[model samples]
Target: MKNLQPIISVESDAKMSKCRTLIMLISPTLVLAIIPIFLSFIIKKLILMTFLIFFGFSSLAMSASDIYFFIVILLKMRNNELFYQEDNKIYILKK
Candidate 1:
């Protein structure tokens, strides 16, 4: 059987690479922030810990939003691959 992978264009591949690069850039800071967050919890600093947890979660949410977009693009590519071609047009099975 033939492979059913999406035919990714270079432009979109580059954009995904850019998104991955941004994630790589942010990950280190997020990792570093974890130590302080943990320390605040251990020291029983409720106010500081609460604030840090919120801040950390907000940054994580930003990364998650980026990932969500990336996943949507990947799903679109997969859907494109799943279609059949006819008369130079494309379609999928139904029924």
Candidate 2:
């Protein structure tokens, strides 16, 4: 039988793990936030610009809150058993 488990590395150092997590969280948020600003520049319509600016700001706000909640969850889970979900199954990490 093929092993149908997700492999998660739990041996990474704390600093590196934090760095990786931040990058993952920030990169997409930055891209989404910046795209609207850039589009507003290329688009000369005032209405479009206003809409884009609003969208950009709202996305930034939502992303910030999402990142905050994600960090909170991580902190809360730090001492708990880590689990990974794949194909509707949850696998607990063995420390």
Candidate 3:
């Protein structure tokens, strides 16, 4: 069978590189902007813990919010998309 797939040319490769560079640059800025919201949640948790401590309830169990945040961080650390090139076509798989 003759292969009929189009090869990725240099210009498209350059464009992809530029797109990746732009994403890399913008991701950190977005993270920075979101930090304060995460910090506020942590601060709120600390205050709740302090109140519990003062009331002599010393059991410090993980809250649902804490687990949610942890999962979110884990998800963020992993790539959201898987790119596969098959039969000369690009496929993006999202988690």
| lDDT for each residue of candidate 3 in 1-94, tens digit (9 for 90 to 100) | 5774334222232222323433543443334334434444466577764554443322112123333434544454335554333545645455
- Which ranges of candidate 3 are over 4 A from the true structure? 1-19, 45-95
TM-score of 3: 0.23
- lDDT of each residue in 1-95, candidate 2, tens digit only: 57543343223323323334546556656787879978988999999999998998887876775478457646654443444445544344434
Candidate 3 or 1, higher lDDT: 1
**Cα lDDT computed for each candidate against the true fold:** 0.49, 0.61, 0.40
| Top-TM-score structure, candidate number | 2
Which is better, 1 or 2, measured by lDDT? 2
Give the per-residue lDDT digits (tens) of candidate 1, residues 1-95.
55444343112222223334445445544574555566667766778888877776665654564456445544554432333344434343331
Against the true structure, candidate 1 reaches a TM-score of 0.35
lDDT of 1 at 25: 44
- Reference-based TM-score of each model: 0.35, 0.45, 0.23
lDDT score at residue 81, model 3, on the 0-100 scale: 52
Where is model 1 more than 4 Å wrong at Cα?
Answer: 1-37, 66-95
TM-score of 2: 0.45
